[model samples]
Target: MLFLLSPAKSLDYETPVPAEVPATIPHFEAPRGPSTELIRLLREKSPQQIATLMHLSDNLSALNVARYKAWSGRSTPENARQAAFAFDGDVYGGLDARSFTPAQLDWAQAHVCILSGLYGVLRPLDLLQPYRLEMGTALANRHGKDLYAFWGSRIADHLNERLAADRTPVVVNLASQEYFRAVDRKALKARVVECVFEEWKTDRYKIVSFHAKRARGLLARWAVLHKAATPRALEKFDLEGYGFDAEASAPERLVFRRKT
Candidate 1:
């Protein structure tokens, strides 16, 4: 089974990745790759244009502008870090890749894939440069009006290729709707199973964004630690007080709930 995740806006390049943790270039980071074209378009935009386009403050827009300007296709230790270690958001906080052993990271590299607006799909150890582009961004490209159009069926096709070698050939979707939309479901060949994490609200169970995001990472971490290769093994997830809700779960949708 392959695990799907979304990229985080928050990043952490300051934290030093262990020297033993090896890194690889992104699958689509070639000389004339899709990212190169997007960077070329982004380079044309001024800080003010970026501010308006991405709905950012003046400071954040300037920061991203600098990142774009300094961006290089080369993947060196100084310019880039592993994707899993670089992302420092809620989901990543739960993933805690910094604590993972090199062996565990190797396993995650094979099973986990992160969807990105700029770099299509990324494995755990894929080298990542600093940039801020959400999949929902309306930056028009050669493909169409939005990033979704830009990705089209490419993401799904790539996932299919990765899944072809798996015994079960299943995709566990832990991504948000925005990023997942980039994937053309019609083009994907694997069975997709979405995992929903909910917490008890005032009256009943509800999906709180923060808890849900963290839970997704927690699930991935649990899978990595346990080497869970089958969908059935995922049902055993009980991290952070969560329990599988058999009543709310279906074959395509697995629901996990927590009292807190």
Candidate 2:
């Protein structure tokens, strides 16, 4: 089984990561052309243009501008951090990768993939530079209009390749729609199962974005901790108040609901 997750915009590179887990280069660049092309394009844009494009504040835009300028695509332990450890959004908060043991990280490195705008697809231990280009961003590229077009079927093909090696060959999609859309569903050979987390509100069960994102992270963490090898193994996940709702679930969509 393979798990897909979205990269976080908020980063925590300042925090110290455990020294035991050595950082690895992202597969996008090595043995290939420079992956810094996106950064090159980004660098062409002025800070003001970037601010308008990404709808960021002056300070945030300037910060990212500096980041893009400093991005060398050549990542080292001293300059860059692992994708899992650097991400500090709600999802990463629940993932808490800093607490994961070396063995758990090893499992995650093989089983998990993080979808990104700049780096394309990343493994858990992949080294990453700090930047903020969301998958949903409308940055026009040579491929077409958006990042999705630039990525096209490449992400799907990579996932299919990874799935081909797996025994179960199933994709557990924990990523949001924006990120998942980057993957070409028709090209992928693996069965895709989406995990949904919902809360029982006053009237009905609804998906709260914040809670659902965190739940996705928690589920990923649980899967790594237990070394889930199949989609069926994931059905047993019951993290943070979430319980699998078989009645509400379908073959493609697994629903987990929390009463709170």
TM-score on alpha carbons, each prediction: 0.98, 0.96
- Most TM-score-accurate candidate: 1
lDDT of 1 by residue, 69-175 (tens): 99887777889999999999999987888888888999999999999999999998999999999999999988899999989999999999998887768999999
> Per-candidate RMSD vs. true structure?
0.9, 1.3
The per-model lDDT (C-alpha) reads 0.92, 0.89
Give the 10-residue window scoring lowest on summed lDDT in candidate 1.
70-79
Count of backbone collisions in candidate 2: 0
lDDT at position 169, candidate 1:
87
Question: How much is the lDDT of residue 98 in candidate 2?
Answer: 82
lDDT of 1: 0.92
- Alpha-carbon deviation at 27 in model 1, angstroms: 0.2
Q: Considering summed lDDT, which 10 consecutive residues are worst modelled in model 2?
A: 29-38
Model 2, residue 54: distance off in Å is 0.7
